[model samples]
Target: MSSSITTILTKKSYPPIGHYSQAFRANGHIWVSGQIAADADGNLLKRSMSEQAHQICKNTSKILQAAGSSLEKTVKVTVFATDFSKLPEFNSVYNTYFPQKPPRSAAEVSRLPLDVEVMMEVVALVDPGDEAKL
Candidate 1:
């Protein structure tokens, strides 16, 4: 038996700088790639932790949308940050996107692509009817 995999992309989000889809949909789930604070053109942004978190969420949202999912459907999220002390700042913005507060794990890392302060990846359910359209 074989399954179909859909590559998700959106011009509204930061273009992938590397050879990877923004997200992939398969088996009723959308796996969004780790997103950083970058603009649509892929220029990394210099912003406060809260602002960066918001941008990352927005970028993730666009990718999810392209995959026929949304942040509200997110099941899991993993965050990597260069500073733990700014977690409060990141959470403040994160709560706005995920009011239900899906399961999440976070860790302080030494560095990330482009040295952005934070990067986030998500896994979300594919909307029932939307999957057939893929």
Candidate 2:
């Protein structure tokens, strides 16, 4: 790793639900923290599983952008949800955004805050050509 590369863990991108930056950067790669189904205002969105999943995607996209990356460039993601029954609907929303289909890992947990159904973390490389944005 080059010393020029560093980690930036700031709370500006997303509010700290517990203790975490919405995303961080290191070695030219950005590792996004798990973003819940919350809006820019950090308020939990109370909606159906599908809608909540969409919001989580939106939140993740924003965080990646803030780190000089894009959803299309994401290499992998980890999705968290409480209900596997919502998989079909969640996939519908997810596929719409990630048309290229990056690598992903998903899990069905027992619960999420605000009765939310979805959350996600993403990892992407900062395009060397776009280093100015970082």
Clashing pairs in 1: none
Give the best candidate by TM-score: 1
Report the alpha-carbon TM-score of model 1 versus the true structure.
Answer: 0.95
The Cα local distance difference test for each model comes to 0.90, 0.77
**Given candidate 2, what's the lDDT at residue 99?**
94
Clash count, candidate 2:
0
Write model 1 residue lDDT over 42-106, tens digit each, in one string: 88889898889889999999888888889999999999999999999999999999998999999
After superposition, which runs of candidate 1 have C-alpha atoms over 4 Å from their true positions?
none
Check candidate 2 and list the clashing pairs.
none
Model 1 residue 120 lDDT score: 97
Model 2 alpha-carbon drift over 4 Å, by segment = 1-13
